[model samples]
Target: MAAELSILVVAGGRGSRAGQGLPKQYRKLAGKSVLARTLEAMHAAAPAARLTVVIHPDDQALYAETVSELAASARAALSAPALGGALRQESVRNGLEAIGREGEPEIVLVHDAARPFADPGLVARAIEAARAHGAAVPGAPLNDTVKEVDANGFVVATPDRARLRAVQTPQAFRFSLILAAHRAAAAGGREYTDDAMIAEAAGCAVHVFDGDPQNFKLTTPQDFARAMEQLKAPSLADLPDVRMGQGYDVHAFAAGDKVWLGGVAIPHSHALAGHSDADVLMHAVTDAVLGAIAEGDIGAHFPPSDPQWKGAASEIFLVHACRLVRERGGMIAHIDATVVCEAPKIGPHREAIRASLARIMGIDVGRVAIKATTTEKLGFTGRGEGIAALAIATVRLPEG
Candidate 1:
């Protein structure tokens, strides 16, 4: 039989570094306490798993107050708090021992209360890894170079960046393996930072799984300020509403001295054939913007079937789509488009197209990307018969 899973949340730290009227874990983030968010993630990952939340003896009242804000199911999922010791290692040992008394669960996940961004997928991966290898921790690859320094703060060595990883908690372990490891450490009067290290000291194999960049620990005062900014940052799922829309348009070559793309007229032997200026790029962008707001495509707004649009600039269509976004209480986050053509060489015009589109859409140039490619002499674009464009837009809006 596979071992059942359980959780041990260590919330014993004072979080003094985070500067507290309250512990950082108990502080509000996005209108909810950090610990509450952490618990919600844990419960969402494995509702059946037994939960043992460890805290400082003096923090019982604070813990109760925090637990009160959780939903009924979440409150019911928590076991009685385990009183922690002076050291973080001791606190985890206390949690492990408590689980042992209640009937040992086969797998246990030990996590910090400060990292509220723990996702259910990570939790499930940790549990699976631990069950296979007996001990595992989630970690992400470091983007910056790391160094090993002495007490004097002199850098002794710069480690290879490729092999280095910054580890995170929700360290998982097989029940008997971790319990025995912690028991051995306590018996020897030894201590370590995390359960993975303790398991490593006891000659147990430890493994690493991918971790999320957003699952950062809330420690320093600066981190709290950054968290506030992150709450406003782009997250498709966490935001009130985010939608993506795609657009594609094609136009055949016609007799003209210049061709228009993204509202910019470039000297060319042939122009795109369309009721409007035949700016495929602008038309694609317009459709994408319209689709994101769910107001239909460019044809719905300005049909080629309507003679008034004949010889009109495509930029006006794009502007109308953008206006609809504003009217719907939304903003465009990004627009990416690809142009397919063998003629009129898109290399020199790429930046111009992006800039022109940005100006027309009333957004920063950084938010737009215009790329060009050919069909490798395989399609109509390769034969120089027409130009085609594909685009996608990302938009953010208020929830209904």
Candidate 2:
């Protein structure tokens, strides 16, 4: 059987240096909080691992809000937050001890909450190294010459850059070994900067593995700005294919009391007629997403001629379209959708529809835009004969 794994996220710092009047982990990066993104990344890397977060006592409310921002699956993978101690070492120790009580895991990864880019490959390597060597840390090679300076700033000794590595976390270790090391350090009234250092002090031979340069930590205001810039506009080399697709769908009135739009049912005099649940908005959004990737439309994928698709929920179609985008190494950047209807007032359910689409697409609600309008009694929608929806989906795909 594979070894059981757990992850400890240390996020106790007040982030006085980051200068956002809030903890750096709680600060918004892109559309989500840094801590939320970190947790999501960790969950994505190790889907089976149990995760716990160490947070400052004063940040309980802030932490709750951050947790609410995560996707349901990611949030479900998390254990309750552990109250952090004054120092990073104490915070990690608290996390480890808390998880230990829930029954120990074979391997534990101690990660910094400020670092949100530890991809799955890096995490897999860390796990393999820990299992083989008992203790390991991810390390990137130093790119500059190193010097040991005296008190007056004169160079005392020059060190070979090739022999040194800049270490990062998600540092992995055997659960029992690290727990004992932390306990011994606490008993001796000693504090180490990181878990790897404590493991070394405990006479464990720590191994270093390759680390990604992009897995950098957020420490200063400049670092935060750089991270935001990177997210806003990742290099073309990473995502060179940006495409926008437009989709329009319409459904005429049928004999029913409700109509489904964007996965929400609204009470109406008549329902929309279609092979599926007749969610015009969701259909347009799905086709828009597929079109952005140059994939065929809804009919081409889930043909109305297929009996299995009859009466199926439109949410299923949108979910499949989003999955296809992900499988192609692409992401849905944003979705802008407009609903044209005369009978059912859409203003009351605008936010609900956006939330529903966001949940189905597995993206933030901020990336989805839902708008409603009518044709002034001019077209089929204006004639109350049918409802129509138009959508534009923006997506980013890797270069060929």
Candidate 3:
């Protein structure tokens, strides 16, 4: 049976206690907004899960800009925007109602958008447990001794750490059960901190799964700064420097020609229209090299307006990029590129593309790699439109 799950992302909190001007979910963390990262993990766990983001009416502008980078699958799976109510329980009820409008799913996952670091594995496990037992939650084993104190400041019984697990999202449940539970709570004027609590109050048995220690939610200013520092200088061994840059080019598809991608000719009805053979793979690689060196891109070195470069082979662009890197006392270490298109099988010519790029960059063929994937018949490249390529290059910096 297909797993039809819906996600209700609660992002409407004012975060007054956290002292952030914007909601905690809207706060920036690790070079991107927290909500975006949370949504990313959710979509990765179940790409087809219907998404309903509960947002404050005032934060519509912020939501639009921050969620623009979400995967296409995620964007398509979203429900209409639902404005949150006065309390977390009310907000969740509103979100569930919005999702219910579009044919209620068998299972629903309620997640905190502020908890951007939640693992996709945890999400999957929660969903699996929910499927088996109707309710599931992820929790970390308690590490500290717990004590209960009365209002008069008298210490009570100590809770056992072995039996206690601090719970975390995503809390998954049967759609009908949670919907009724949320509505009943809202009607009775009860507000709970988490979905698990809401479920427990309603007498729903929740199964616990392993939770990751690194998936702490960002709440305060210090948490935000620490998350950024973690991304900038990761403690993991052998991580790349992670230099990033964007490249874009337009090429009209003309009739009666085979398209060459990453130096391999594919049996396409039309070729990319451009001067100098319009090889998108080479252009992308050249731009990546320039980006690595902090220099300008393909346009700066080979302008279309320049007569000398008109109709010139794109291999020269790759060759010139290698020369520039060598001039700066650096070497071409490796190049990995992906060609995006919908026509003329790309798998057959991947090897040839790798060899050609290796020759142009003057590196071993093993140092060059090419991959091809389609947009699954969606965007410009997906509709038998022109092809595009994205590339990432790695190089070792010399000792000063």
Candidate 4:
């Protein structure tokens, strides 16, 4: 029963101390935000865990923008952020209260959004330790000698270094007990720097487990710089796996007033006939993207036999193909598509088609190329009986 877990990521602080224009947790790190990586680590460690985030109320737009970089699964696992208070402790309390409204969790992991290097293994260790004990925190042994200082800035007591532990978050606890502790603290008009103290005040025994030195929190601009240096992606062009794929599609014309092409509806004397809207250009590009990822074709993803996809806007297919590429850690370097038709005059709408494709694919306009061609009385397109499209996609994948 205690195995069911919930994790709360605290990202409410403005991070003004970090000397960044954005919150430290929202700043880019290793091609992703610190909070994104933090959420990813927690999800990887406990796939079954429910996740919640706490944020400053004014940061809704910023939060939305930052979370877009997360993987789809991680984003889906997250609950809407609980509006935070002025202090870190209050913010975490708000998150806890919000998570309570959902359901009671057996185990709860309270994590700092600024620490992105806490990997799944470390999280697992903390979870195990917490389940064994009433509460537990991940901490590393002190490498520096410690001394207690007074208000005069003079050493009052020199403590043994062996007993000192620098605790880090993803502090784990029994949900009920920690919740009770936080509520009690709030009622008493008290606040602590971290959740462990609340547990300690509530007479719950908290244990410490081995922690990674790399799981350091970003506190200032210098700290962020150091983290960037540690986590930045190095030169990887040489190790990349580049791939190219091609697709071709043809659709016969039927009487209609307009036709959909590359997500844009253009006035035409006839519309393409197919199970879907038969945006010939979109079908070709989608197939090309899927092929580049070695993931079959558009037909596999959007089967014509399924009633759900009947008369579907074909842009859905292209979006799916693009998402597949992203899920595989691949990106579209370029997508070049050619339209073949003897009528409808594609020359008048070439740029519009390209822009539409770029929007659907979530790529830049420069990366999407659309051109028009004619069979010149050589085939069906030459006779105005149908339209054909050919697409070539270039993809870049990370090497193993």
- Which candidate wins on TM-score? 2
- Model 3 CA lDDT for position 219: 75
Q: Tell me the lDDT of model 4 at 112.
A: 93
Which parts of model 2 have CA positions greater than 4 angstroms off? 1-3, 233-400
| Candidate numbers sorted by TM-score from highest down | 2, 1, 3, 4
User: Over the full model, what C-alpha lDDT does candidate 4 score relative to the true structure?
Assistant: 0.83
TM-score of 3: 0.59
Model 3 global lDDT (CA atoms, 0 to 1): 0.76
Better of 1 and 3 by TM-score: 1
TM-score of each: 0.60, 0.61, 0.59, 0.58
What digit string (tens of lDDT, one per residue) describes model 4 on residues 1-400?
3237899999999888998488788888867888888888777656678889999998899889877977787888888899999888889889988888888888889999999877654676677677778699998999888989999999999999899899998999888888899999999898799999999998998999877777899998899888977664333263288899899999999989887888788999999899989899888998899899889997786679977567766766776677677656667889999999888888888888887777566578999888898977888999989999999999888886
Q: How does each model score on lDDT? A: 0.84, 0.89, 0.76, 0.83
As a TM-score, model 4 comes out at: 0.58
Please list the residue runs of candidate 4 whose C-alpha ends up more than 4 Å from where it truly belongs after superposition: 1-3, 233-400
Q: Rank the candidates by lDDT, best first.
A: 2, 1, 4, 3
Per-residue lDDT of model 1, residues 235-344, tens digit only: 44534688889999999999988889887788899878889789998888889988888889988887889875677767667866876775566778999999898888
RMSD of each: 17.9, 13.2, 16.0, 14.9
* TM-score-superior candidate, 2 or 4: 2
In candidate 4, the residue pairs with backbone N, CA or C atoms under 3 Å apart (3 or more residues apart, or in different chains) clash, namely none
Better of 1 and 2 by lDDT: 2
Ten-residue region with minimum lDDT total, candidate 4: 230-239
Which lDDT tens digits does candidate 2 get at residues 1-400? 3329999999999888888578899999987999999999888667779989999999999999999999898888889899999888888999999999888999999999999977765786788788888999999999999999999999999998998999999999999999999999998898788899999999999999878777899999999988986576343357778999999999999999999988788999999999989999999999999999889999998899987567877876786787777667777889999999888999999998998788677688999999999999998999999999999999999878
